[model samples]
Target: MLIRINQDAHPIAPSEITPESLYRGRRNFIRAAGLGAAALAVSPAFAAAKLGAIQKSPLSSTEAPTALKSVISYNNFYEFGTGKEDPARNAGRFKTRPWTVRVDGLCAKPRTFAIDDLLKLAPLEERIYRMRCVEGWSMVIPWNGFPLASLLKQVEPLGSAKFVEFVTAADRATMPGLALPVLDWPYTEGLRIDEAMHPLTILALGLYGEELLAQNGAPLRLVVPWKYGFKGAKSLVSIRLTDKQPATAWNIAAPNEYGFYSNVNPEVDHPRWSQASERRIGEFTKRKTLPFNGYADHVARLYAGMDLRKFY
Candidate 1:
């Protein structure tokens, strides 16, 4: 069932959107710095390159998007580093091109798709989604990509495929944080077959109308806005359809703290933080955290008859 949320009731005006020229100008300034990847990684002036034609999606949220600077600079890509700003400061040399995603396991048409081929597979759309972190912070980001279902359908899962596992790229050379004994290397995430095929779940390629920066999971990433940001695995390398629930990075690292289904539930607080309210990025005040990050009406049915507190 395709469920459309009401968040898009107030569509953003064209004038409110950031201009592409501004991003190009920022890229030019970074080029002039001549500091190469190091400069690009640390400089707040660095911006993503422009993408080809894109179509606006009706699934977008009406909330004002967080500034591009904050969206790129303040990140949680632990493959680069643990600090919130570490991704932006350390992912300067990370490579994303020539990337390919392998889709296999319990599927009839298992095949590896190059990043270029994936881009051409479907028409890209802009989806402004509300991202909620387990740390109690949030951001409304304009993500550019196509529905994950669009790609999953191409492989055609078998009846035995009950879950989907996502494996991220873990390059020791480019990702320095791999040296540290953090959660685990090659971050992994998963979703039930129904959730995987949800219309709102997208495979993001870029943000703010530009190709994604290395710090932002360039080339490809999963974006499930209803769940905590950690559920959106970055720099994905493989997608496997499995009969058993695959172990995820966080859930494996701390099962008590991070559940397999990390849906946004205001009633269920994080072990270290409260999930009832959240501080939106760039805002001084906190707002009530909506169930499923304000997508309850569209996604609540997926969890019907299940105890969120227990399953969460």
Candidate 2:
């Protein structure tokens, strides 16, 4: 089934349908009540199989997408649990509604935007991106959202802004895993000012042509295609622009394992495992990893002259 919203209201469309073995080859996740008014505003089959104004980005991968089940059921959202399947099982009860994101720190205008208001800030686009996890696994996902820079521009960052920090929520009532001291509470991630403002960086609001499921960081999340998957913090509650580099969850927990840059480099091996190759989610055999997760051409210049090994 296809879903759509009114373009005048800024619709978030899905990518073109691929082989059933590729993307959107799973159960429909969005219900009538999930989108509420947005779903009601347009025809039932609005923008069938099209991503509306959200165009297919050139940087997206052409490879077949990982199964939706694998994408949702297997993840590293510690807010739900440490196990791979923990998020899918435990995140169902997590409350994503009534969500808001506070944009503050070194910016000319700092304000809190409710999810609905945020959606109206700019038109949503569909971007298919490759997500490589620090655990050496990977997947290609189609995300629905707008460029994060657009939102940042609205607030107008000051000259002092050098870094962008993303902080997640830690409510035990919604997120049971918060009870555990795993990786510290309120997960955080960061990006350099230039990196954060890059067109490749986006705020993901949905996937597979539907509203995002809680297990997948519903409401709002970050998607930095060139960086490791963990670098994109889920369930984002706040965005802070600061003059100094901000602390990230993994970097704080185990500086030796994860780094501030966390760029996808085959040459830099994880302390416990090799990052030279990774297993595609649905495939058995592993594939050679690429520099900057195969986005080196578009992003390599950003890190030119810097020792990636030392910085990462």
Candidate 3:
């Protein structure tokens, strides 16, 4: 399942990687600032726990990971709020434990898995992936989880199943933004069955060596490195396999701007903006956006004869 990288082609300088000490220090700083305490007030549900025995995946990108601070602080979790800083600032009291994810529809062994049960489904892997947003921003994230195909296999998708749908949690009490009619409530996303089975698609449980924070889709979330960041649904509540393409939140909200495939294609520009280049969160200058966010070699075949501009 490994996608071999040509080190010479994508050279990662030693200075580029964020120091582990610095990553830990940032979390400590957050705790000292009372954000950690706020989370503890609701319960230890959002408390960060270090994932044990994480296996490093060969499918990982060698690029330096974005700073933990920026990764957590700047996000697009609209359930919490519309502003970039809103999720981090507002999700402190959100509870994530005692969560369950139901996997059903067109499956032989449809079942609901507790958060703890899903964690034990497969050995966790640390995959450093480059995540690109349709808005021309990108980040390298060290995501900890297993390939989503492992979970799908357990449910035993039927022959009739051709797509996978993800439903995200939308607690009105905790997620203030849910009150706003921005898109549909209980955010949903979907992928073609083959895309769901891709090795590059993972069900992320944690990031940066620790369990995810509430703002960053704690408990469980989808991570498709070859696709735009919005394709990665957060705080997942259910995963359904079906024969038809499921309705996705963004595609429903604005079909002209968001496509169902949502692959990172630089050639197909967003209606209001060009997608040829992107600004890395901490970088000064914009870098040329690569096809499939630079994972084209590993995933382009999935689309073979289809026109990307048309499908996109």
Give the clash count for each candidate: 0, 0, 0
Checking candidate 3 for backbone clashes, the offending pairs are none
Model 3 spans > 4 angstroms off: 1-46
Residue runs of model 1 more than 4 Å from their true location after superposition: 1-47
Superposed on all Cα atoms, the candidates' RMSDs to the truth, in angstroms, are 7.9, 9.5, 7.8
RMSD of 2: 9.5
Task: Let me know the TM-score candidate 1 reaches against the reference structure.
Answer: 0.87
Q: Give the best candidate by lDDT.
A: 3
TM-scores for every candidate against the unseen true structure? 0.87, 0.84, 0.87
Candidate 1 lDDT trough over 10 residues, lowest sum: 38-47
Worst 10 residues of 2 by lDDT: 40-49
> Candidate 3 on 108-213: residue-level lDDT in tens?
9999999999889999999999999988999999999999999999999999999999999999998889999997988999999999999999999999998888
The segments of candidate 2 whose C-alpha lies over 4 angstroms from its true place after superposition are 1-53
Of the pair 1 and 2, which is ahead by TM-score?
Answer: 1
Ranking of candidates on lDDT, top first: 3, 1, 2
Q: Each prediction's Cα lDDT score?
A: 0.90, 0.84, 0.91
Error of 3 at 200 (Å): 0.4
